[model samples]
Target: MSGKITQSNNFIYTALALIALLISASLVNVMPEGILEYIIEGFTLLTFGVCILSLRFDKAWTRFMVSIIICWLAATLLYRLFAIEMLDYLILVLMMVFFWGTFRSIARQILFVGDVDTNKVIGSIVLFLLIGLIWSIIYILIIVVSPQAFNGVDGGPWRHNLSQLTYFSFVTLTTLGYGDISPRTPFAQVMVYMEAIAGVFYMAIVVASLVSAGLSQTKNSRE
Candidate 1:
């Protein structure tokens, strides 16, 4: 049972990291624009599918939340494929809720787990990437609501906009101000600072939690 659990955890973390890589690649501008969008969509769907499958549902509520995520994914894809502009806003709202739920679920699992094993370490990394993705989604939402939210982003479809924003998200999360992308609006500026702070605090908390878990495991072994 333990081996199976570890395998499942490894698969999910791998998928998460792969999705982040795909997004990063999309930002490099080397790939043909049309093909990159398709690749990103495919990988995103695959990542979400893996996340849903690998999630450890400990209660009825979590199971229900998973179902909701499935429905959100389906709706978002449909709207994107059909180019339904009005409904795309609704999709953004759903995406925010889904991402928040996912972050909460994963954070809870990591914080409450009894052992500081490889799985937990991988989970911590996944959580960090998830935070970046969540902030990216928020940046997208800001752009959607206000066209002037940010500067230096190319004018194109929403898919194209995400490529740049996703890159900017991780950059800001790591406190690496590349100066390539800047927030034009006050709200966007505030969000940028907030994400920076969140990134710092999250790292500090994860390190402390891991150290605590490791000490507890060592004490138990000595006993």
Candidate 2:
């Protein structure tokens, strides 16, 4: 809310998100076995778009968020229909960009919103926590309902369920692992660990940087 956003940056992000959606759709129900990267790949680009939107949420915040949802929906439909290896790899690149943009957005929000009106700040915090909590709870419920199918992880009964996969993804994202469900395959382990590291860095480096910077500035101004 404090800084100005360039239209060029927004258009770039929108373009990437849109392409990711279209590519993801093309692979629907068409990917080969042992390759479930399509979903991740699709979401990686889509989420990057969301992260970008977070930064420059000016007059078009609502519309931008809606567009993100539409992209996700399109991706989901595509993954269900076809699968593609190349597209999955492309998603990896998207994830890299997404992580960077996500942390940047968080840092900026923490910095800019600190000086805003109390009610508005509090409302934003509550809204963020609420949406995050609701999403996690529903995800956990789905995992609990069909643990076997989800935990199977080998095109078994849980291929469609995706509970275990989703669970691990969040666990790694939040850097919380209860040890009940873990990555069995080497590739899975690598993915989860990478996510955990990314989460840690985001919190420690970006979030902490914003908070500490604010504190230092406030202290200096008082002096």
Candidate 3:
């Protein structure tokens, strides 16, 4: 109710949003399939939990972008757990928003690391964690959703597809295109290609920014 309390709630929500992204990413990609999908679903609990939190949080333009991506990451993970179908175009829109928003936020943080402290530094690690998180969520969604659209036999290796999808998402997200498990459907191909471009641009921009900024800082330190 109070202004200070409101601000505090907002800050906490933003932080929690970042945390959910990291934690879900870990469960989705790093764990095995049997109970792991269920465990991964557990992360969806964070999504509902964060809904009110997301509403409460207020952020800067930069931080706003970061939080938007967080929303997509959380939503996609939830969709993965329950949707059990391939991504529709709307989901792709959300994914692109999440991907671009995350990429920009990371580039800003890495390039302008000023007055950053212990907590903020750990939070900074989310930049890297996020890439895996968002990609894995989408991949899982693809594996799960693609079945309903691409296959009719009610057999799509739900777990195995998810696991492979994780790898494939990162491969495409990173623009690696390993020539294995390529998309057979137009929907998958479109999603993969778009994500691949996003991935490539994100790295190009962020890495360049980091390198330039780091070099500049080094030169200043030497002076």
Structural similarity to truth (TM-score) of each candidate? 0.84, 0.40, 0.49
Clashing residue pairs, backbone N/CA/C < 3 A, model 3? 85-145, 86-145, 86-146
Displacement of the residue 70 alpha carbon in candidate 3, Å: 13
Off by over 4 Å in 2: 1-151, 154-159
Error of 1 at 122 (Å): 0.8
User: Best by TM-score, which number?
Assistant: 1
> What are the Cα lDDT values of the candidates?
0.73, 0.45, 0.52
lDDT of 2 by residue, 7-117 (tens): 323433443443454345335346675464546444544545544564456444445444544554564456556765333323333333333334334434544344433
Worst 10 residues of 2 by lDDT: 126-135
Which candidate should be chosen as best, given lDDT against the real structure? Answer: 1
- Write the residue-wise lDDT of candidate 1 on 31-127 in tens digits: 6756775666566656655566566454654576677667767776787679777666665566567566667877887874577877778778778
Candidate 3, which ten residues in sequence have the lowest lDDT sum?
Answer: 149-158
Candidate 1: clashing pairs of residues:
none
Global CA lDDT computed for model 3: 0.52
In model 1, the runs with Cα more than 4 Å from the true position are 1-21, 24-37, 59-62, 77-82
Residue-wise C-alpha lDDT for candidate 3, range 60-100, written one tens digit per residue: 54466556556656665666678734433344456546544
